[model samples]
Target chain A: MKKINRRQLLQGMVTGAGCVAAASMFGSAAFAADTRIRHFWWGNPSRDERTYKVIDLFKNANPGFDVAGETIGWGDYWTKMATQTAGKNMADLVQMDYRFLFEYVHRGALLPLDEYFGKTLHLEDFDKSAIAGGMVDGKLYALNIGSNSQVMIYNKRLFAEAGIEFDPIKWNQAEQMDIAKKLSASTPKGVHGIDDATMNPIVWEAWTQQRGKTFYADGKVQAVAADLESFWEYWKEMRESGAAPSADVSVANLGFKMTESGIVTGATAMSQFWSNQIVGVQSLMKDEIGAAMLAHKKGGMPGQFIKPSMFMALTRDTKNPELATKYMNAWVNDPAQTAILGLERGVPASSKVRAALEPNLTVSEKVSVDYFNAIQSSVGPLPPPPPKGAGEVNAAFIRMGTNVILGRISIKDGAAEFIDEASSIVERAS
Target chain B: MRKFFVRNLPGYAFLTPWLLGFFLLALGPMLISLYLSFTKWDMVGDPQWVGLAQYEYMFLKDKRFWQSLDVTFTYVILAVPARLAFALMIAIVLDKGIRKIGIYRALYYLPSILGASIAIAILWREIFNIDGVVNAVLINFGIQGPNWIGNPDTSLYTLVVLAMWQFGSPMLIFLAGLRNIPTELYEAAEIDAASKAKQFFSITLPLLAPVLFFNIILQTIEAFKTFSSAFIISNGDGSPADSLLFFTIYLFNEAFTYFRMGYASALAWTLLIIIGLFTAVSFYTSKYWVYYENERD
Candidate 1:
């Protein structure tokens, strides 16, 4: 055997190392190609299982792309996303909320979808209002996943027991109170007529909107005092009449999730929630829970609106912007995918998707869809974007409610404080 | 000098790791924070220079800042003395020959190690909840209990009690200080017909003054910076009308929840200055009370 020259030996070693590196890189790429796109949505196990089945169907239909599903609890979703975004590591696709979309978009952490769905994502086929909800400053930040409306859920058994023949659609404060009083009188031990929500800002906003007032005007709070005072008076009456739970019970109930909600758990006969949450509440109850238009005063403008429940946006930080847009488009537009998702995120915004899912829907899903449809013509205009420090404002609302419920403050005083605090928060944020 | 460097080169090399870490990790961040204190930042966009505007707003306009300061000072004033008294009493009790003294010592010391954690704070919330064990115990005695964690009037007091409960660390230090006092002094006092109380005031207290001083300073600082228990118990909202809103918790809210990083940084500097003033006052006052065993006057 003859010895090779030094140059030839060095060249041979280099070539061999390069070939090995290339082979490993090729192997990884091939492995990645075979793996499914990991999609995450915040939900409970039931929703997770359903989503997994949907992903399986997607993989089957689209052979080249496999999709993995992940679900987190709603509370942990934003926190996890914020941390992931800060670390410059995020899932391929995520369920996004309207509140957080601005945070992501402004931070350049989400991909805009102007080119993905036509030259600009066309609004002609979509409900213009719903499509507009997902746009920020004329740029499409997220694809509208679904639309939801607020509805009142009541126990039919409770209503029958109270002998209350109330039409929530046309009920005034006096009529609703009459029904509430009857229900309170007839409600058995360990149950109440209503699960009072003193902390719900949206409820106050809706009431005010019905009165032709808005929460904001000229970038300042416009309807805080009147809206808050009305809400406080309403809740105070309910509390005084034994229609709502005591302060302690109410606080504990506030901490409970949808499954453990007082209404669903039979502690109360009626509650207000987003239409999409109907199924989760119904699943926890033995009694049949039914939906109605949120109770309003007679001749009042219906303040209910079909707002985008949430959106799915591609992060700007994503290395594969085109891929992210394609994934979001698929999630939003694909009828097969929406059919499996159903009214889990309210009604799918895409008409085609909604139609596809409508035929095979469960009773609960149909109820939600019907609820939204009934109020479609009655809804007021979409609300403006909530100001920053909105969270602090909400907390302040809860605190004021606690004070009122505890009898530490009068309803009028609590209302005044809430308005003052909320306005201050808006001012600070501005 | 050249010979010394050659001989001590390995020793210097060994110290380099710690020296590098101190400058890079601790000192670097401290300087950065100082600079950040003067700027208005929200963690998203670039920081804006605001000079002393944040400080001015905090000192002049922010009612929450003053409220938090009052709460924190009240906590420090009550909690530090109460904690010291409890620790000193326990230390003296344990110093007496008792059965299973070591076991009692270890058992009492356990909470100090675990008390400051997030888990314990959550557990504290549960223990103080309306339907929790404390209420159950009260109810068993035919007594209805107030909502301890949910009541604004009693919420801060509950935290004060929690701080006082973790007296084991201070007690341990006091015990060591108690033991270090020369037995001869006590013995001489005993021969002189000195009462136990008298001996305590004359010998034990004087000798332990240094330790007591140290404990007061440390505990006051700890009480001032209390955040975890207040934050977790309040679910990070300073609930029931900001009753449990400690200074650091308020600072955290401004920094993270409200995204007022510049304001929070100014708050940080204010806290440092306050603590420095407190430490300075303690030192100045120590001359009148604290005794030094090693001093030659």
Candidate 2:
């Protein structure tokens, strides 16, 4: 090696780094003319593939229009979104969740879509209630792509093997519990009849709805100690009766991948799924998956309600606002686009699109649509979007719920702690 | 001053990149985080000054903070010593005359080379999964294995076992240290008819004290910073009643997951102090045990 001075080495290093950085900058600049608008959404592989296909369709129609699609598992989406928001690099189009919409809107992270409705977007065929769900302070900030409700999907093969009578409608929680106890007895060793719902907030929220109580109202916790105590007691019973799998089995099955879910892995016969996820859930397993309305109190109010499966929002940081709005319209209301997207997002929010696409839905897609429609009359109005600090409340719920399920804490104490923590978390954020 | 500058020009020039990097990246961010520890802010908005309230809450109220500390300490206490002992044992065995010693050393060091990778973390998760290899082996012995990764009682221990399995770097250090101990001493012990155990205690251990202490500090610090494997195995949020809630994982969650940047800053400072205290105490106590070959005094 030639003798090298320290100054010479430093100069070489600086030149090398400068060249690499300049190369990368030019590398992206080469494609800057493509008129790209990035879209970000969280979904399973099935929904993601359809989204990619739809993007391709749009690109083919509008020459030079480019979309870079980004997808993540549901758990990591908001973390990524929050980081992006802080950096002011949010994608042009965002698939938003109902719970986080209020926070994003309050922070002025999303654009109000009221201006885009008449020109770049036409949403006349969309449901009023679905649109209203995305409204905050009378300004439409997001457009619901589809409407979904909570549903219980069961393994029909497992039910058949156990010789249980299938009752898709008019069933009560008591009957479900009895079926849970009876079905587990007939299933194979270590396989439970019901998935563990102790840590799932949706199941608890549905129970609160069933009993004519709201879990959250006007950015304050409306759930009382009794609401949690009773809900936890039910799951505690579910676990003790061998109806639900043990915590270990449940945690293992709760892997980030959809394929590892309890129902898909044959760890449980019945599991909770959103009506929109029926097809995605079905795609993971070989068995025929069936879904029904969630069981409620025998004479209680309707527990399930139609809520936006997800919404497409235009980010405040978007460079191409008009193009983003046009894409949003295509995603939400365009019949041709819906033909490609189908019920993967949820049952279509637009009636015109739904009717046009119904005749062509796959077997699982039809099942989801039928289940969504069957509960139409009994379902409640769209729930108020979760208050700010809903994320903290949810994390606490899972942690405290895990404590109770694993016998680490008493039911009464766990419920009390959860309500207190959730209330405080909501209050603090406000 | 001109003469001084000219004489040191090359050295200063060589240091410019690292100096710039330190100021721009490491030291600058560290100072900002220290300031941020006194404020309450999500990353999206302007930071509001809370003035020690973040630290106050962490010290006085945060249950998860205590849980994370407890979990991390338990890991350090259990894993560091066990790892050191295993590495020392393996080093001693490998020090004996053996064919193809270089290959054996490389083979033994493979796990540590891959230890910090996400792939290994995922593989660890898979091996402890319900239908994974560990349970399969346990089944043959008519022993039903509890979910190692899921059960709170065993999850941290499984991570400790993983820590022990990757003792390659320390083992290599121990091998080098063992070589430095002259074979003449062992031969003298043999002439005295000292038992193998007696010779080890008298000759091997005391001679290896400095290296042992060095490995202890290295391994303990490494254990404190354990994040990736714990984060992966716990499925990110420290599930099954927060049993796998390592301190670093909790700090990450507070920062990113909950958007509690201010509290997270306080947590980062607290961890720094804790690791600093541990290192200081280790050095303080090392005087009693560590035997240096050269005595300055």
Candidate 3:
């Protein structure tokens, strides 16, 4: 048997502890070299697949770069992003939205990409307006992935069945409602004419813009109560006239996918969606679909504007921003990568990439391009980026609108409550 | 002190992991949250001291706060009693005289295991949708069913029914409690020519009171804290005019969705107080009904 004294035992324990401390320190340092930066974005499966392919191409292009990707559905994206933000573990490369980009930038979560525009990222080929949309307070914090405008997507078969042939750009709200009633009268028993868009903030934004005011300006709710009341009153009348689906149906399909929407499910003949959503809606249906501009306000201010489809940004705390920026460059600037992504993200922000991909574009994608070109000049100026706490305002709009359309509250009352609620929500953020 | 330390050394060593977790993960965050409840924290910036401002806003300025409280209280009040009563009824049925009761027990308990999941909530949404199974079934009987999860008036009841459907675990506990009741007492009642109803009123009610009390408290707290089903069903914004906004979902939205960490912390403490008050009330009232075998009520 071996005998051990206190000196020997103490010395052995100290050496072991020292060894563990050194191993842990060095182990983490080594782990950093092999760390695969995580990239997170929200998209449907098609976008997810294409993004993975682009990441693969990026890896091939830069052998030293390694990336792990996470894609969330649009509905769950913000929840995941916010939780990760709170935990200080946000993805290295984040796909941002115009509404959220300002909030993130204001929170110091996003790194300004302006300094790297020429050094690491190639912005020479990107559109001036596209680049402008990604700017916050004159500093570029994100890169526009694509450009998009809202479009009214109607089922062609439903339109033909209803004997309705209307030009999207020329149609006014009254004419649109008349067409909706015609379609509803001719459609199946359970079907309505138009999916309700009153709860959608985009519609309200357009409505507010038509009256020469924006929904939000200078971090405040800018629309007057009268404008809001008129917007709600019109929708309430539409619901009562059966030109749009009932409040119950709209509520049930709330936050649903294009595949599960009233238009695709044949419960409504027409629905309005972002231009990029056209392809996703097309994939789910055998029925032919047609695209048109949203009905303009009759003799009112311009109601349409081109906006960034989404933005690609770098998180401030990323370990490898250079590697991430290189990948972002490939995602938007590389012709080969851009072609694979196609119109899934909308028209490419890079004019060169757009021209290159236009010839090989699918028929549906061609429609989006033609629509974008047709409305490019007539559309209004882009509204200011949505303010912080804009999300709460959007929620309040949906809730109060539901109340009005469901006859639970008068339009005037709902409008008053909404202004009170929305203004406070915006003010609280500032 | 030395002798105590020596005697408890092995136990302390074994408890180290849990103790560390409790202090670092739970208690540490809890203390920070308590401090945060008195400040304004946006999660990305330094916290600002704004004593009682969050509470004042929640009570005086925020309509959704009061709305969520009403919704949660209504849910707990309705769901707990309905769930417990349903559980007790089934437990009595199973305990009285069933062969191969294990299969029946497992079948009944399945929903409890799966009920609170997001998948089940999605399934619930599908079943209650405008063109879903319930409405499809109703059509066959020449009756039009209102959209169950869409109409605000009816949406809450659907969630309540969901709560009642997961009564399996409470039922199992009641089963165990029923088994513990002595057969001799029933025999004695029978020998005295007591009626079945009379025996149940005299023996079963008093004996099973403790289990019922436990189930009531547990289920009430569970109902108050429900998030996934309400979240999934309402698509996380508690749409249809915020009818499905449970307290926890509202708190989550305030914290993660709105990034109002201090406000969320305040909401958390309010919920803690609400649950504590409810549990205390239940315990205080228990002496009126609950009876133990060895101790007097």
Candidate 4:
């Protein structure tokens, strides 16, 4: 009798476990029928959480449509995207950067959104410049999420301590150097006045633009070697004068976040960041931080231009383009969604949405929005989207800058090498 | 054939999964990649047969290709021997009158399992950063440490140390090799008044040469294929003037970042050849040193 009881128990256990497995398998199958499209983007944890919330809102609003979101860290986003593109298995909705837009669009990996502008996407409220920034070869391959420009973000506490009256818009090349030197002289040991921008392509782009040349144009690097040489020489002098951190520290902090940035760490008085990044930086610091324009060149043209923070692109192979388009529309146009996403991507590219969110704006958001508004007339026209091989050229620019900063290569030689390498890359790419 | 299939049915069944995986996954991609090496494939477009152009570019024009090779070679030369030597030392020490050998062995082997993990690589980056724990400790001692991961001069060395830190597997193998040596041989040398150092040089080393040969080949191949540590350390761009640009990192960048898949494929094939040559060289050199127990004169 006991043996029979044991046999019954064993049978019951097996049946129960099998039923549970079968139920879960079928349960997921039912859920899978909800037209679930995959979305991919890169962001810090906070942005990821907010994005997921926005995705949830989209899902809730439209039953039977779902976006299964995937987020990789900033460092790994590109390599993963390339692999997915090669496999012809890209996510339906992808976050795109302007620098990378031309490459993807030219490869036909992106869907042209022009056909859907009136039919599915309602872009009436978006600023013309924001929409224009996403256009390539007359086809709208992406839609701008927001607009931003590079701004000089400084530690206000450090400036106040150094007794310098900082006016970022008026501070050109000479004033910046003088302030950097003054701050460096007054700061404690191990602290520098400015973070190094010697190797940053963004700064070089502005510098070259100020000199009436684009860093890259017409599918080639247009900046003259003499200009790059002067830029390097200027930065080199700054380093030598104890105005910036040593090359090693600068290299370490390259692409670092606020926590490790010289501005937040009190190792430097000033650094450059995108206008939208102020809130993120402030969140990580106890110090009072302020934003300013990247210093203009002495006797040079206006170089600053607002750029799309990022774009929402639909992959060419997406099985659910309409739903994806709807999701993207909600992302850029929905007031509630915009409120939640509020300048995380950047100040809203949609004028309607920006105006709607104005009444509920936090002080920090107002500051960024006001700054972008105030700088409108002063900034230059947006340059064309970087062409193919621009990624390699940008990397080479940084590397040559490092070589100059480290004293490994003379400024003249570095500039010459950069021009040769960048020209070849661009030529081959074209 | 029917009889053979019936007789070896269980064996074939056991091998089927791996066989299916090999043909479907590994072999298919490898074959495609080999074909791709001769083409100008941007991965998103049609692959154009450019026959030897990618190879020509890699060999003659790409400065980064040569730089990555130099970095990888330096890493392999330094890391493999240091790792093996450290493994051997620990194995010998553990072989001597040590207590709780099982626990000690497990403790020592933990890093080998964790070494290649992304978490560990991240931890390593933090440990070597300018404001990291190493510098924090150095500051306490009034010694300002160089930016280990930032400074190009010291970046590769930090990666080498990371490679050396995961010597547990080799150490375990060496321990087994040490145990297998006949106790009688060491006793005989001792009876003949051989000192410990002399005994180690003559009897122990000669017996250990085969083990050493095996380890050198394996570790050399491994060191060549190391990607994750360098990739994570350099943030995938091999920054700080490309000092940490390993061969694989360069290959990955060419293929993905630069959209030069065909060129990257050529680089992959070239690396395979280089590894093959190193293995062959090691085998050729082994004849002079390696001694088999069964092959006495």
Per-model DockQ: 0.09, 0.29, 0.25, 0.22
As for DockQ, the candidate ahead, 1 or 4, is 4
Score residue B98 of candidate 3 by CA lDDT.
Answer: 91
Deviation from native of the Cα of residue B227 in model 3, angstroms: 1.8
By summed lDDT, the worst window of 10 consecutive residues in model 2 chain B runs over: B288-297
Tens-place lDDT per residue, model 2, B1-297, is: 999999999999999999997676666777778888899978777889999899888889888899999999999999999999999999999999689999999999999989889999999988998778999999999988888887777889989999999999999989998988989999999999999999999999998887777678668777888889888888887766789899888988888787888888888888877776776677778778877765456
Recovered native contacts in candidate 1, as a fraction? 0.12
Instruction: Quote the lDDT for A428 in model 3.
Output: 90
Clashes of each: 7, 0, 0, 0
Per-residue error at B108 for model 4, in Å? 2.7
- Please state the error at residue A36 of candidate 2 in Å: 3.6
Candidate 3 lDDT by residue in tens digits, B30-147? 7788788899987777799999999999999888999999999889989999999999899999997899999999999999999978889999999998888999999999988888
Q: For candidate 3, lDDT tens digit of each residue in A1-430?
A: 1222324433543332221101000001112443467788998778999999988887887777688888988767887787677667788889899888988898899998877778889999878888899888889998889889988888899899889989877688888889989988888887888888778777888888989998888777888889888887787767778878877778777675676788888889888899988887887788888888888888988888999988888997688787778788888888789888998988888878888987887778877888888888678999988888887888888888777767788878888889988888888987
Please give each candidate's TM-score: 0.85, 0.92, 0.93, 0.92
Taking every candidate in turn, the Cα RMSD to the unseen true structure, in Å, is 11.3, 5.2, 8.1, 8.4
* Model 2: residue A28 alpha-carbon error in angstroms: 11
- What ordering of candidates by TM-score runs from best to worst? 3, 2, 4, 1
**Descending-DockQ candidate ranking:** 2, 3, 4, 1
Name the regions of candidate 3 deviating beyond 4 angstroms: A1-31, A34-37, A83-89
